[model samples]
Target: MFKHLKSDLPASVVVFFIALPLCLGIALASGAPLFSGLIAGIVGGIVVGALSGSHIGVSGPAAGLAAIVLVAIGTLGSWENFLLAVVLGGVIQLVFGFLKAGIIGYYFPSSVIKGMLTGIGIIIILKQIPHFFGYDADPEGDFAFFQVDGENTFSEILQTFNNISPGATLIALIGLGILILWSSVLSKKGKFFQLVQGPLVAVVIGIIFYNLTKGSDLWGISTDHLVSVPVPEDASSFLAQFSFPNFGAIGNPQIWVTAFTIALVASLETLLCVEATDKLDPHKRVTPTNRELLAQGTGNIISGLIGGLPITQVIVRSSANIQSGGRTKLSAIIHGFFLLISVILIPRLLNMIPLSVLAAVLFIVGYKLAKPALFKTMYDLGWKQFVPFIVTVLGIIFTDLLVGIALGLLVGIVVILIKSYQNSHFLHIEDKSNGKHKIKMTLAEEVTFFNKGAILKELDSLPRDTYLELDVRKTRYLDNDIIEILDDFAFKAQERNIDIHLISERGMVENPPSFIEFFKLRPKSA
Candidate 1:
C-alpha cells in the first residue's frame, strides 16, 4: 500500500474533497442527523478500506439507502431505533459473505453493469440541479419518484426554480466557472494545477466569494444563499449531537423488516460498486468480493453502533476515488480519517464552504460518469447492449436505481433467452444410397428446460423413414426436463422407421433402449 505513497496521497486529497459533501448529503437524505452521515463516511473509508482487498474502491453512505433509511426511521419512530436495524443489517451482510454469496456479482451481465453505472450518472446530474440553484428542501438531493415531503422529483425541481435564491445562483455560477477552468484549462497547464484538485479550488473560491458578499447589501446575497454548516459551540456541545439507539424497539417486527431492507439494498449496492470499481481500476485489480462484503458488513455494524447511517461500497464515492487517481486502499482509509478529524477539529471551517462550491465539484463528477462519449460507446456496442443501457438510463431517470436495474436485467435476460432459443438445434439432411434420408441433429452445448420448445420443434420436423444421428458429444449438461423430451422423441422416431444413433461422451449407442435409460447408464465397473 505504501508503494504508491506519492500518488495515493494526492489521490486521497481529491477523494477527501469529493467525499465531504456526499457524506453530509447522504445523511441528510436518510433523514438521519447530518453528523451520522459523517460518521458512516469515516467508518467506510477507514474500517472498510483497511480491510478490503480493493486497491481503489471507496465506501460511504449511499444515496441508494436514503429512501430505505427515511422509511425505517419513520416506521421505527426514531433515528436511534433505525441504528439498531443498521447494525443487524451489517450482521446479515457478514452472513452473506460467509455463505460465499458474493459470487452472485459474477453472474450479472456486463451490459447490465454498465447500464447501472450510466443510470446512476444521469440520476446524480438530475438530483443535484436543485441544490445547484440553492434549493435545500431535501438536504442531500434525494432523487425518488416521490419525496418524503410528498412531492415528486420533477415537482421539487419546478418548485426550486420558482423559488430560486439569487445569491445562491450567483455563487453556484462562480463556483462552476472555477471548477471548469481548473479542469479544462489550469489542469493541463502545469503539474501544480493538476495536483491542486478542482473541487478544492471551487470551494476556496466559494468561501472567498461568500465573505466578500457577507456584509454588502447591494450584492443581494441573503443568508439563505450561504452554506448551512451545523456548528456546535464546544466539545461537550458537539458530543451532545450524537444519538443513541433505542434498544427497547428490538421487539418490533417492523424493525426486522427495516433491518432486512438495509442488508439487501446495502449488499447489492456494495457488490455493484465492487464490480464497477474493478472495471475502472487502471491496474485491472480484481477485488475479493467476499472479503469486501465482510468489510462492508463490519463497517455498517460499527457505524450503526455509533449512531451513524448504514454503509456500503457506494459507486459514486468509488468512482470519485478512481477518477482522483487513488492507487491504493490507503487513500480511502486516509479520507475517512480526515472526515473524523474535520468534524471534531474544524467544524467551523467546514461550515464556511458554500453548497454551490460542492455542487460545482459534483457537477464535474456527474459529467465524468455520464459523458457523451459513454453514450456513444454503448450505442456502438449494438442493440443487445444499447437497449438495456438505454432502458436503465431512462428507468433510473424516471423511476429509481433498483427499479432501473431490474428493468435492465429483465431486458438482458430476454436477449439471452432469445439467443439461446435461436441456437438450440442444428440439423443436416442428405440422401442416402439405400433409399433413406441420412439426417444429423446436434443439440446445443447445454440443453436446459428453456430449450425444450426449440428442441421439440426440431425433432417433430424430421421426415418419416429417415436415418437420424443425435450428437451430444459437445454438450456438457442435459437437464432432466430436456432428457424427457429426447426420450419421447426416441419412441416417435421408431414409429416413423427413423433408426436413431446417439453419440455422447459415454460412447456411441446405436438403437438405444430409451433416451432416459440411455442417459442414466453410467460407465461399467472397471
Candidate 2:
C-alpha cells in the first residue's frame, strides 16, 4: 500500500478536500450534529480504510443514508438513542460479513454497475452546478433529486439563477479553469504539477479569493457559501463534541428496528459502491467484499460509540480518489488522517475555502465518469446493455442512487428474461417434403419454465399433416413444465396427423409415450 506513496499522497489530499464538506453536509442533512459527520468520515477513512481489502474504494458517512438517519433519529426519540442504533447496525454488518453475504455484490450485472457509475457522475454534475454558481440552498452531499430544502434537482438549478454570488462565481470559474488547465495541460508538463494536484491549487486560490473579497458587498463570498466545520474553541469544547450512545435505549424495540434498517441499507450501499469503485480503478483490482463489510461494520461501531453517523463505502469520494490517481488503500487512510487533523488544527483556515471551488473540483470528476463518448459506446453495445445503462442514468438524475439501480437491475433482469425467451429453442423448416410440412425443433441446453411459452407457441402453430422432428441432443436440463407441454403436444400431433420423430443422443423413438417417462427411463443425455 505504501509503495505508491508519491501518487497516493497527492490523491489523498484531493480526496480529503472532497470529503471534508461532504462529511459536514451529510451530517447536517441527517439532522445530526455537524461534528458527528466528521467523526464518521474520520472513522470511515482511518478505520475502514485500514481494514478493507479494496485498494481504491473510500468509506465515509454516505449521503444516501442521510434521510434514513434523519427519520431514525426522530423515530427513535433521541440523538443518543440513534447512536445506539448505529452501533447495533455495525454489529449486524459484522454478522453479515461472517456469514459471507458479500457474495451478493457479484450478482449485480456489469451493465448495471457501469450504469451506476455513470448515473452518479451525472448526479454529481447536476447537483454541483448550483453550488458552482454560488447557490447554496442544498447541502453538498444531498444527491437525491428532491432535497430537504423543498426544491427538486432541476428546480434548484432554476433557483441558482436568481441567487448567484459574484465573487463565488468568479472564483468558481477560475478554479474550474485551473482544474482544466492542470488536468489537460500543466500536469503533463512535469512531476511537480502532478504531485501538487490541480484541486489543491484551486482550493488555495479560492481561499485567497475569499479573503481578498471579504469586505466587498458586491463581490464578497459569504460564510454561508463556505465549508462549515464546527468551530471548537478549546480542548474542553472540542472534547464536548463527542456524544456517547445511550445504552438505556437498548430495550426499545424501535431502536433494534432502526439498527437493522441501518445495517441492511448500509450493507447494500457498501456492496454497490465496492462494485462501482472496482470498475473505476485503472488497475482493475477486485476488492474483497466480505472484508469490506467487516471493515465498515467496525467503523460504524466506532463511529456510533463516539457520536458519529453510520458509515459506508461512498462512491463519490472513491471515484475522486481513483480519478486523482490513488493507487492503494494508503491514500484513503491518509485522507482520513487529514480530515481528523484539519478539523482539529486548521478548521478556521479550512472554512475559508468556498463551496463553489469544491463544486469546480467535482465538475471535473463528474465529467470524467459520464463522458459523452461512453454514451455512444454503450449504445453500440446494443439495446440489452444500453437500455439498462440509460435507464439507470436517467433514474439517478430523476430520483436517487438505490432507486435508479433498482430500476436498472429490474430492466436488466427483464432483458435477460427476454433473451432467454428468444433463445429457448431453434426451429428449422425443410421445403415441404412429400407435400407435407416438415419442421425440426432443437431445444436449447437447460430449457426451463421461462421457455414454456415459446416452446408451446411453436408447437401450437405447427400445421396439420405436419412431419415433426423433436431433437434434444444438446439439452441437459428440461423443466417438467416443458415436458408436460411436449406430452400434450404429442397427443395433439395425432389429431393433426403430425408424425413425430424424437431424436436424442440415446437413440430415436418413433413416438414417445411421455417425455417425462422417457426422460425418467433414460439417463439425461449430455
Candidate 3:
C-alpha cells in the first residue's frame, strides 16, 4: 500500500487538516477533555490504520456517538469510570471481530451503498457551507439534524449567509480558485504540482491571509474562524492530559451496560464506514471488514487505556483522504503522525490557519461525492435504483448517517421483494382444446422464498379442469420453500380437477407422483 507514497503523502496532509477540527469538536460535544479527542484521533489513525486492511479509510473520534458519550459520562459518575467502559467496549469489539461478525457489511445493497456515498457527499457540502462563510456558531464536524449547540443544520447555514465575514469569504474564494486551477491546469505541468496538492496550497494561502489581514479592520478573520488545537502551557500540563481507566469501576453493572452500548454502536458505525469508504475507493478495492473491526477494537483499547473517546472509521476524514488522492493506508497513518506532532510542536502555527480554507477543501470533496452525473446515472437505471438512492440522499441530509442508511436499506429490501415476485416468471395460456385450457408457466432462472407468494398466487388461480405445464428448464436453483408450495398446490390441484406436467433440465414428468417427491428423486442437478 505504501507504494503510492507520492499520492498518499499529499492526501494525508489534506486529511490531517480535515480531521483536526473534527477531533476537537467531537470531544467538546462529548463532554470530555479537549485532549481526549486528539488522543482518539492519533490512536485511530496510527493504531487502526496500521492494523486495518483498508486502502484509504481513516479512523477517528466519531460525531455519531457524541450524545451517548455525553450522557454515559454523567451516568458513569466520573471520566475514570467512563474510561473503564471504553476499555470493556474494546474487549467486546475484539470478540466481535474474532467472531467474524463483519460479514454483516456484505448484506447491505449496492444501491443503498451508493446512496450512502451520495448522501454523505450532499451532507458534507451542506454541513460545510456555514463554516465556509465563517460562521463559527456551530462546532466542526457535527452531522446531526439538531446540533449539540442548539442550531439546526439548515438554520446555521442561513445564519452564516446573513453574517458572512468579508475576510473569510475572500480567503475561501481564493482557496477554491487555487484548488480548481491546480486540478485543471497546474497538475498537468510537472511533478511539482502533483507533489504540492491544492489543499496544501489553500492552507498556505489561508495562513498568508491571516498574517496579512491582522492589521486591516475590515479584512481580518477572527480567532473564532481559525482551526482550534489545544496547546499545553508546560511539559507537566501536557503529561496531565492523559487519563487512565479506573479498574474499581469494572464491577459496576452500569459500566457493563455502557461498555456494551459503546461496543455495539462503535462496531456498527465502523462497519458502515468500511462499506461506504470501499464504495468510494476509485480502485474499487474491498477492505477486510473483520480485520477492520479488529483494528478498531485495538485502537479503542489503546485509546481507553490512555484518555480518549471511542473511535470509528470517520466518513469526513476518509472522504477527504480519497478526494485528495489518497491511494493507500499510509495516508491515514501519516495523518495520525501529523495530529501527534502538531499539538506537541506547532499547535500555535496550526491555530493560525483559517477554517474557511479547510471548509473549501471539504467543498470540493463534497462535490466529487455528490456529483450531479451520479444522480443522472442512477435515474437512468430506473426507479428500482433511483428511489432508494434519492431516499438515502434525502435521509442523510434530513436526518443523520445511520438513520438515512436504514431508510435506504428498507427501500432496497422492498424493491428486492418486488423484483423477486416479478421474476417468478410469466404464466400464459398456450392452447385450448376439448373444452380444456393448456397453461404454460416458465420458472425464473432461480427461485427462492421471495418468489413463494407469487408462485402460490398463480397456483391458486389455475382454472379447473385445465392442463398446467410448469417449466423449470431455465432454473438453476430452486428453494425448498417453493418446492413445498408446489407440493401443497399439487394436493389442491387435484381438488380443482387440474392436470399437472413438470418440465425440468433432466426431462418432463407427466402427472408426477408428487412435486416435492419428484424433485427429491431427481439428482440435485436440477
**Cα RMSDs of all predictions?**
2.8, 1.1, 2.4
Show model 1 residue runs off by greater than 4 Å: 215-221, 248-252, 431-437, 494-497, 505-513, 522-526
Q: Rank the candidates by lDDT, best first.
A: 2, 3, 1
Please give the range of 10 consecutive residues that has the lowest summed lDDT in model 1. 219-228
lDDT, residue 317, model 2: 94
> For candidate 3, lDDT tens digit of each residue in 144-225?
7888768888888888889899999899999999999999999999999999998888999899999999968799999999
CA lDDT scores, all candidates in order: 0.81, 0.93, 0.89
Q: Give the clashing pairs for model 3.
A: none
TM-score of 2: 0.98
Residue pairs of candidate 2 with colliding backbone atoms: none
Model 3, 280: alpha-carbon shift in Å?
2.9
Candidate 1 overall Cα lDDT vs. reference? 0.81
Sorted on TM-score, best first, the list reads 2, 3, 1
Candidate 2 residue lDDT tens string, 299-417: 99999999999999999999999999999999999999999999999999999999999999999989898999999999999999999999999998899998999999999999999
lDDT of 3 at 352: 94
